[model samples]
Target: MSDANNQTKAAPKHSAMHIAVGLLARRDYSRQQIQLKLQQKQYDADEIETTLDHCQQSGYLDDARFAALLLKSHISKGHGVNKIRQSMQQKGLSRALIEQVLLDSECDWFEVAKLKAQKKYGEAVPLDHPTRAKCIRYLMGQGFDYEQANYALAVEVD
Candidate 1:
């Protein structure tokens, strides 16, 4: 590449609306994530704000829908309730809504963890301290807490 081309100071000029649609069409993201991405792309601040406002009003940027989708995806992947909640929170879902949706789903939170543990470690179970600790850490990294991790491990390990 020419030095002039490399040295160019012009930032990207992606159409704000187009970028929003393209991003949404590909996958869901928290509103803040989207805003940050726009800023990172060097979009004019006012344009970015206006585009987000318009998109939100048009129902193209819905936090609740995004949270629900994330929750469902994580659960289907055999995640526990605690793990799912933490993931949603990390993705910027409101705590109240996360709890409400989790409750409404009627998902057996503990059971989900138990099933996941059983699948990974087998019916033979891993009850020993070292093995159980490993299992607990795995669950926590997947977003579960110590309690949920222990509970789930116990179901299979005990």
Candidate 2:
């Protein structure tokens, strides 16, 4: 009976800091993502806020670092600027932060688009309207702008 009672009482509640640290140890999270996760874990609102503040002050929770890592990962995966921007926004990053990260990035979207297109569709422009449109759609889906996608399709096959 006592065992059953203890089990029913719920697991001991972890401190917000401990929970936040555990989450951080697994992967980087934006402040908003951390806050949302803490909320989902049923931490007290005030405690969650305080813990997040402490994490930020202690340099354990850096949105800039998180954003930079995400941006680099997306770029490496052949994502275009607009797609990366949209993804960052979805992760609750501020427009200013997204813009700042992009502004600081030295990657050339055009070149990336060209390489990605070549890799996927071969190093030649589509020979037909249907094929060209398909190629364009694929690049657009990958976050390349119209001009970049078109420019990539225009590159000669080696």
| Candidate with maximal lDDT | 2
Task: Please report the TM-score between candidate 2 and the true structure.
Answer: 0.92
* Tens digit per residue, CA lDDT, model 1, 1-158: 68788669666666978898799888888787788888888898898899888888988898888888988898889876777887888777788888888877887767777777778887666758898888889987776677777887774323
How do the predictions measure up, each by TM-score? 0.77, 0.92
Residue pairs with colliding backbones in model 2 are: none
- Which residue runs does candidate 1 get wrong by more than 4 Å? 1-12, 155-158
Model 2: per-residue Cα lDDT over 1-158, one tens digit each: 99999889988889989999998988999999999999998999999999999999998999999999999999889889989999999998999999999999988999999989988987566779998999999999999999999998894657
Candidate 2 regions with alpha-carbon error over 4 angstroms: 2-4, 7-9
